[model samples]
Target: METGFPWGSAPSVDLSLWRADAIVLFDWLMSTDLNAVPITHPAQKQALADLLARLEEVGITESTEEEIAAPRKMWQGHGLGGAPIDQSSVTRAQGSMTQDIT
Candidate 1:
């Protein structure tokens, strides 16, 4: 399976996100204090800034209340509340699985 990116051939890749998610992400990123974060390289900071600028250019900076609320409702409905997963069951299930070694 060729899962990894072909970095040698591809110079840049496009990113696609739901409009509501993109708006929320942009708002969060805008409110974050980059100075407090321990970013060593200047390019990293510039890259983040560039992302924000692109978002702004695409009208992600301004969103309607419905747009913002829709994603929150969708997430809540899907049970993605940022809760930590219960790993005990996962470990047990993994242990029970038979490995087919060729």
Candidate 2:
């Protein structure tokens, strides 16, 4: 088995050696270390763009300009205030009786 660079080894020029090397590239991308290695190949960039276009066709793409906005229903009076409570008050009055005790 051949060993690659150290923990922070620089990027290799060979793309054929990349399946394993790409992992290191991903680590760099996550750490905001843009200078370590360049993974900006033309083919990779095109592939990513194609994937994003397909996702947009299914409405999964995130874009601020063409966002789907819907009117939010106001729930201010969706509870008892929106319902009729007069019948309940009448029923309570009819169920009660005045009792006298000496």
Distance from true location, Cα of 49 in model 2, Å:
0.6
lDDT of each: 0.61, 0.34
Q: Candidate 1, which ten residues in sequence have the lowest lDDT sum?
A: 93-102
Measured over all alpha carbons after superposition, the RMSD of each candidate to the real structure, in angstroms, is 12.1, 26.6
Candidate 1 TM-score to native: 0.54
Best by TM-score: 1
Q: Give lDDT tens digits, candidate 1, residues 33-83.
A: 877657889778866776777778777757787866755654553335665
Task: Write model 2 residue lDDT over 11-70, tens digit each, in one string.
Answer: 433122211122323333344533434466756654444433333443333323212121
Evaluated against the true structure, the overall lDDT of model 2 is 0.34
- lDDT, candidate 1, at 57: 73
